[model samples]
Target: MRLSHLADYAVVLMTAAARYPAGARLSATELAADTGVPLPTTQKLMGQLAGCGLLTSARGAAGGFALALPAADISLADIVEAVEGPIALTLCSDSNNHECILDAHCRVKPHMGVVGNAVRGALGAVSLTELAR
Candidate 1:
């Protein structure tokens, strides 16, 4: 499945963040300028990423945002999940999903987990360090 534009923007934003020196804090405007993402979208995404524990924020004259973990510790899957939730290829693959009308007779449901996991694994294999480069 194709990723949403917002998810793609999140990845672009995150890779820019990962380029800063270790523990370097950056503002949304700075990230927007660097990554070419809109300032408002960058601000919203920074909040979402921080809420998901991928980023840490501080308040004051020196306040800004920084990655909570090293670039190597963060993966493409983490960034995608931060903005797009879990990487389920279909509704049936999601554990909390029980609203599918074909749930009772769908043969593809069981195997969707493997497909979802494989997709997520492929994303997980790509680290932010690699993307930043």
Candidate 2:
């Protein structure tokens, strides 16, 4: 599955935040400048990430953003899910299954379960700290 630009930027932003000398708060514009991402997009992603609990935002002169938890405690899947929701390879495999016509008769549901588990496992193997490194 291809990650959207927003998802890519989210990773970039999070990784950059991870680089800070722990507890260092950085503004969206600062993150954007550091990562070469557009300022507006970084601001939007920062708000979304903060809302998702992946980031904590402080207000005032020293206001900025920082990870809510340690980099090691956060997984890539957590970031992906926080920004993009569940990881599904197809509509039939989606948790909602709202658009699947073969919900009952699909022969691949069992196999898809295995595939999904493997995918999640692989993603879970890599933590945000690993990505940051």
Candidate 3:
């Protein structure tokens, strides 16, 4: 499945953040300028990322948003999932999903979780450090 535009933008914003030295705090406007993402979207995403514990937000003249973990500790899957929720390619793979039209007789339904996990695993293998390069 293709990533939503928001997810893609989140990745872009995160990679730019990763380029900064560890503990370097930056504003959403700075990130928006660095990555070319819209300021409003970047602001919204920064809040979500902070809410999800991927980022830490603070107030004051010297405070802004910073990575809660090292760049290596954050994965592409983390970024994608943070912005778009879990990565479930099919309805069957989504544990909370119960609205399937083919629930009665779908042979491949049982295996979709494995497929979805594999996809997430693949994404998890790529770190922000790698993306920043």
Candidate 4:
């Protein structure tokens, strides 16, 4: 249930972007410097985020990255899913249900669903602008 470093970094990177004046483009190097994340990792995450439509990249000199949409339109869950895929507390809770022996009669699954919903709600309630604050 722990978020990976990349997910955390994605939040940091996006939060930095949120801090910029809306529509302002920032290079990965600038974002990395601003957030204290490494340059290479920032660039990689920036590319991934752009692919996810969370960011837009411009080419050539004086070009960089900018938010594809308004910060208020973006949520923590969106960033998390964009970087880490689905959110599941346990294998039994996973929609894939690959092969969990307890799938038949898992009492915990129901409770886990509640926990998962709470987590999702909490994440969904916070917009990128809230994080920037």
The lDDT per prediction is 0.93, 0.86, 0.93, 0.91
Query: How many residue pairs collide in each prediction?
Result: 0, 0, 0, 0
Query: Which stretches in model 4 have alpha-carbon errors above 4 Å?
Result: none
Q: Please say which candidate is ahead in TM-score: 1 or 2.
A: 1
> Which residue pairs in candidate 1 collide?
none
- Could you give candidate 1's per-residue lDDT for residues 1-133 as a string of tens digits? 8888889999998899999999998999999999889999999999999999999999888999999999999999999999999999887788795687888898999899999999999999999999999
Report the error of model 4 at residue 124, Å: 0.8
- Model 2: how large is the Cα RMSD against the reference? 1.5
Cα TM-score per model: 0.96, 0.91, 0.96, 0.90
Clashing pairs in 3: none
Query: Which pairs clash in the backbone of model 4?
Result: none
Between candidates 2 and 4, the one scoring higher on lDDT is 4
Q: Per-residue alpha-carbon lDDT of model 2 for 1-133, expressed as tens digits? A: 7789998899999999998878889999899999999999999999999999989999999889999999998888777777888877776676674766677787887687678778878887888888888
Tens digits of per-residue lDDT, candidate 3, 1-133, equal 8899999999998899999999999999999999899999999999999999999999999999999999999999999999988989875778775877888999999998899899999999999999999
